[model samples]
Target chain A: MALSDVYDFYRRMEDENVILSFKGEFTSELLTSILHIMETKMVTMGISPKMKKRVFNVLVECFQNLYHHIEATGDSPKQIALQKSALIMVIHENEKIIVRTGNYIPSNGIEKLKERLSFVNGLTEEKLRELYQNRLLKNKLSSKGTAGLGLIDIARKSKNKLGFEFIEINENTSFFCLDVVIE
Target chain B: MEILLLEGSAKTPEINFNQDTGVLELRGRSIPENSIEFFKPLNDWVDIYGSSPKETTQIEVRLEYFNTSSSKCILDLFKRLEQLDGNSTEVKVNWYFEKDDEDMEEAGVDYEAIVDLPFKIIEVEEI
Candidate 1:
C-alpha cells in the first residue's frame, strides 16, 4: 500500500468513527483483548451500564461467531490465507453502535446462512424472544460446539433487525458480511 | 458428596456447589468459547445432587456477562435442578444483577419464565 492510499484509508476510518477494527485470525485470546479494549472505551466515554452491557453482549457474539464459523480446513495455502481473511469493525453511527464482520465462507453454505439471517430479520421483538427461547430449549450443540444461537442472541440483544450480504468471491468461497446495530 | 469448587477466569465463572448443604453458587463472567465443556461438571453435579437433595436447596447465580453458549448451558443446569422431587426438595434460585444492568435483569426474567422452580430476581450494588 502506498503512503497516499494509507492516508486515504486512515481518513475514511476516522470519518466513519471506527472505534476499533481488526483483520486476521480470530482467536479466543484475541476476542478477550478486544472486549477489554471496548469495555475501557465505553467506560471512558461515560456510557451507562445498561448500554455498555448491550454492546458487550453483542460484541462477544460477533467475534465468537467469526471464531467458530471461519473454518480453516487444512494447512493449504488457501486455508492459511483464510486465517487473515476475516475482518471486524466497531463503528459509531449517530447514537448507535454498528458492529460489522466479514469473512470468506464456503459458497455451498450461503443459502442456509441467508435463510437463517432472513428468518431472524423478519421477526418482531416479541417474536424474536419467542424464537430465542424455543431454540434455547430445543436445540443441542452441534459437533462444531455451537448451539446455533449466535444470530438470534445478537438480534435480541440489539433489539433490531439483522442486515447481511453474500458476495460471490469465487465458485468455492463467498464473502459473508453481517451488520448488527445497537441502539 | 463433596463440594464442587472451580475458580473463575476471563472466560469461565466461579462455581461452588455444595452437595451436603445444597447451596450452589455461581458467580462472575461466563463467556467460554465452549460453554458445554465448561458447564458439564456443574450439570453433572446437579444430576447427582437431585437424587438426594436437601429439604431446601438454594442456588445463587451472579453472572456479570455471559455469551450465547453459556446462556444455553445455564438453562440446561437449571432444567436439571427442576428435576428434583419438589415434595422433598425445595429448590429456589436467587439471581442477582448489578445496578444499571437491565440486560442481566431481563436475562434473569427470561430464565424465570422457562424454569419450573421458584426464582428470585435480586438487585445488588455490584457482582
Candidate 2:
C-alpha cells in the first residue's frame, strides 16, 4: 500500500496493457460504475460503436457471472474478507479486449463449473448456438438467479474459448479465475 | 388492474406495463444483481393480465444490454405471454436492437428461436 509500491504496480499494469481493473467487493452498484468507466473509456478511445457495444455486453455478462460466482460466500469474517476481494481486470492486447474475473468458490463447486466451461468451449459456433438455446429452454433459474447460460453466452459472444483456472486456496475453497476475449 | 410503471436505474430497466392497453414496454439496461427478484412482479403481471387481456398484447423490448440472469428472466416473461391460452389475447413482441449492435440483434433472434411467440426483430436507430 506504499506510494512506490503503487507506482510499481501502475508501471506493471501499463507494461501488461491492463486498461481497467478492480479488486474488492463486487456489488451491483459498484459494477455498474465500473461498467460506466469502461464504456466511457471505450468512447474516449474512439473505437467503432459496434465494438463498443459488443465489449459492453461481454463486460456485463462477466460481472454478472462474478456476482453469481461469489455472492454465496461463507459468513465468517475471514471468509467474507477473502470473498469480498473478487477481481476483474480488462486487458487490451493485440487490438483485442480481454475481460477477466476471479473469485473464491467452494471446492465442491469446481467440478460442475469446470464441466460447464469445458462443455461451452468445446463446441463449434453452430453447436454452441444450439446448446445455448437448449439450455435456455430447459434450465430454470437457480436460487442464485443464474440459469447456467452465462458461460455459454460468453462463449457465443466472444466466439473464442473461455480461458479459466482454479487455484486451490484450502481444502474447502478454491480461487476461480475466468478470462473472456472480446474481438 | 393498475398500470405497473417502474423507472429505470443504472442497473435496471424502465418498465411500463399497462393492464388495460396490454402494451408492455421494457427499455434500457437490465443488469440487476438479482434479475429474478427484479422481474418477478412483471412476470406475475403477465399471468394476471392473461386472465383478462386485451385483443392485441404488444410487448416492446428495447434493452441496450442485459445480464445473463436478466436474459433468463426476460425469456420467462415472454414465455408467460406465450402461455396465455384464451382467444381474447393475441400476443406479439417487438425486439428492437440498434442498427450497429449485432449482439442485440442476435439476442433477439435467440429468444425468437426458443420462445414460441411471434417476434418481430426490428432494427432501430437507437434504444
Candidate 3:
C-alpha cells in the first residue's frame, strides 16, 4: 500500500535473513515472477550450476503442489488471499539454505500430512531407496496424483529431516509450516 | 509418426525426438508437477518408435536436475531402448554432465551399470 510500508516490510525480510519472499496472487503471472526472481538471484550469487538447477526444480515442485494439490473450500477465498500474502522465505542459517513455506491447511488435512511425514521419517535410507524403486516398478506412467512423494523427494535431496509445525487457527483450519534445509 | 520438440520448463526437460531422424534429445531440468503425466507421452512415443527399429538411435540427455521419481521414468525409458537394440539396431546414449557435477556424472554411470546399452558420459562446460 504505502511506499514506506513496502520498504519497511522488505527491510524486515532482509533483517530476518530472508533472501527471497513472495506474497501475491499465485497466478501464472505470479509464478513466472517468482521463477524469474529466483533465477536472477541464483545467477547473481554465482551458485554452483548443479545447485542452481536443483533450486529451480524445488521451486517448480513446491509451487505446483501449492497450486493444485492443497485442499480448498468455500471459505478458501480468505485463505487464498492469505496465500497471496503467504511467506516463502529462503534464509541462510547454519551454513545451509533453509526454504520455509507457510500456508493454511484445512483441519482435516493435518492428520494426513502428519501421517505421510511419519511414514517417510520411519524409513531407513536403504528402505527409502527400496521403496522408491518399488514404486517405480509397480506404478504406471499415468498415475500422477500427489503420490505423497514430493516431500520424500525433498528429504532425499536435502539429506535432512523435515521440520514442520501445526498452528491451530480454528476448529476447521490450521496454519501449516514446513521448513526444509538444504546443505 | 512425427517428431515432438518441446522446450523444458523449470519442472521438465527440453525434448527433441524425431521419428525420421532418430536423434532423440532431452536436456534441462526435470521435476515436473506430475512426473507420470509429463513422461507418459514420451514413453508411449518411444515405444512406438522402438517398434519401427531405426538403424541408429542416438539419445542425448543433458539433465542438470531431476527428482528421484524422474530418475525412475528415465530408467524405464532406457530399458525400453535397450530392449529394442537387441535386434541389431545400434543405440547410443550420450549422457552429458557439467564438468564439476559429480552427481550427474555418477548418475550416468549408474544407468550404464544397470542397462546393457552403449552409454557414454560426456562432460561439458557450464552454460
Tens-place lDDT per residue, model 2, B1-127, is: 7899999998889999998788999999998877889999998788778888999999999998888788888988888888883458898899999988888898899998888888999999979
**Tens-digit lDDT track of model 3 for A57-127:** 55655665566555556456875576444456677655567777777778888999998877877877667
lDDT of 3 by residue, B57-121 (tens): 99999888776557777888888888888675788999999988766786687688777898999
Q: Could you give me the TM-score of model 1 versus the true structure?
A: 0.93
Query: Who is ahead in DockQ, 1 or 2?
Result: 2
Write down the lDDT of every candidate, Cα atoms only: 0.87, 0.86, 0.73
Cα RMSDs, all models: 1.9, 2.1, 3.5
The better-scoring model by DockQ among 1 and 3 is 1
Per-residue error for A138 in candidate 1, Å, reads 0.8
Candidate 2 has a DockQ of 0.72
TM-score to native of every candidate shown: 0.93, 0.91, 0.80
Deviation in angstroms for B114 in model 1?
A: 1.9
Instruction: Give model 1's TM-score for chain A to 2 decimal places.
Output: 0.93
Model 3, residue A111: C-alpha shift (Å): 2.8
Query: Interface RMSD for every prediction, one decimal?
Result: 1.3, 1.4, 3.6
| Model 1: pairs clashing at backbone N, Cα or C within 3 Å | none
Model 1 gets an lDDT of 0.87
DockQ for each model: 0.71, 0.72, 0.39
